[model samples]
Target: MKAKVFKYKSDGNTVVASYMELEPYAKNVYLSLSRKNEDGNEDDDCFHVVCRIENVYFSSGQYSRRFLKGEDCREEAATYCRNWIADTLQSAERGAFVNLISVRVFEALGLDTTSLVQAREEYKRIQEQKRREQKEKEAEERRVQEEQHQWLLNEQKRKFLDGERITGEMFLEITGRDGFDIHIRTKGTFNRHVRGIDRNGTVSFRKIKGCRTPDFTGCHKAVSAYLAFITEKEGK
Candidate 1:
């Protein structure tokens, strides 16, 4: 559909010109067409078609300016202006101009906005689904971590109860507790006695008081296993 053309005065009524104005299709949006001339001459290059929405302006540019300069220019400008409005509306439907165009504008123009509304709803649905999936993924990760932690604790308890041979490092870790004193005799020698005094002042030895062994490494491993068993029992 073409916009209605009308004549108006320009530059303090010294120049006479005709311009086309379309019906307001959206709130605060206006479309108009005028001759691209300084003195409103008929020999201008082409018509100037523009659409203004709020503070922003969209021009038809060189394409609309190519229309022939004659009485037919008004109809051609109106046709191009209508196409420009349709393009703007299509952009809004795709969410490009979502914040600029409103439902009231579609109603004012008597255009159905079902596709635009559906597009927005679909976008929201996709985002909500993604959030739900992310939450589920995080919950599954936490569940696996907790299961691994429990498995490690169970394995440690089993080894302690079985009296398995532990390293000298393990012995130090167990005796490093607060208020515990580790006593090492015959340092770096074959005959070594490794023991601990607990916070209650009780001595820790492997199956005997002041446990001793000819092999220093053997003594340390035996003491470590004994301390680990005692700590596990205390914890239980």
Candidate 2:
């Protein structure tokens, strides 16, 4: 089958990769080029490469089947491609990015990168677009995390106030009932702490857990209950 080459141009270097599908196995092959830029040029161009492959058929005979490795054919071809790209870059003279790519590499794969210059530009555009989308997504995530952090600080202070100004202990005392304080626990469920207080306050002190932003009221209930129990036990 005739192999197709996809080229992506950068500031200092360009990627010339190969893609092909061979039959009767119909296996897909990808050969990617990784070249380091020596010129240190600022890359303003980026893009993605998508190409159509021409089918390759093998004639059935003793000679044709003799060299075939069946399912391993694609892998073998890919390995050869990778080796050639690396070896060529290493041996190539240091100069321009275009000069770094050897003609022999393309000849070895029966493809040409020079002819796909226009296609390379399009591919670079696609790559740049994808990069922008990724950056936006990451920025949004960071913004959300910052907002969440601020909300946590505000909630912590809010739980401390109730006009008369309740401490973690006082909130539970007034709201607590039956000589028991409200207890709250968390296992990452319910965003905040579990909806309400557990007035029975039977949970072990070690079992009371909290996360970044525990429910404001829930925390008050839990802390008050523990403090109240402590006060009563002390005969205060």
Candidate 3:
């Protein structure tokens, strides 16, 4: 037995269906449906259905090819395809045509659509899980950045307190700056840029509010007191 191929076209000429032959004596048929794109060109998407004559009769084979013998095989296959297009894909709505045909093919094969439904649910579940994972990863990164920033702040404060041992010359030389003013005003309070409390471009200093002695060394005590105040306030 030689295989045969048949093609069907819609009345609007936008869609085409093909009934392709399988192996000779296999008693199986392959149906392919395709539609043209907006520019009237055939798109790459194609939907397919495959079943054997015997299986069709055992299933929903009301118009099954089981009755067709010998020379009527090709004609029977074409007739079945026509009825399928008329009853199953009635509207010729190109967008949903593939989905419609899939339902019909499954019905014709007497197969339940539960697997398809479960597959879709599983896909959604996987996508949602991925979204949660991504969110958690972003949150973890933010926490790590915050921790690093806090650590840097604490380190800067610690060095500022250690500035008590630094001489004024050493401070100026190490900072690599010129024209820095360190002066004591009326009540012996010294106003000076605090060492190690550096902002990228802004000047930072500690005001020795209660100092009655004009000494730059008292600046470290003021910075330490400020640090303690900040820590206590933050905890509260």
How many backbone overlaps does candidate 2 show?
7
Candidate achieving the largest lDDT: 1
lDDT of 2 at 74: 47
Query: Across residues 1-236, which tens digit of lDDT does each residue of candidate 3 receive?
Result: 12222222344323223334333322354533333234543333232334443334211111222233337665665565546534433323322223323443446566665444444455567778999999999999999998886665455444544543433333333222222333344113322443333212112345568865334344544334445555676699
Backbone-clash count (model 3): 0
Q: What is the per-residue lDDT of model 2 for residues 45-137, given as tens digits with 9 covering 90 to 100? A: 211212223332111112123233356754554454445445444433232232323442344456655533333455567778999999999
Per residue, candidate 1 scores C-alpha lDDT tens digits across 52-73 of: 4332334333323334434665
TM-score of each: 0.33, 0.29, 0.30
From the highest TM-score down, the ranking of the candidates is: 1, 3, 2
Query: Once model 2 is optimally superposed onto the true structure by TM-score, how far is the C-alpha of residue 52 displaced, in angstroms?
Result: 21
With a 3 Å backbone cut-off (N, CA, C), the pairs that clash in candidate 3 are: none
Where model 1 places Cα greater than 4 Å from the true spot, the runs are 1-110, 164-236
Candidate whose TM-score is highest? 1
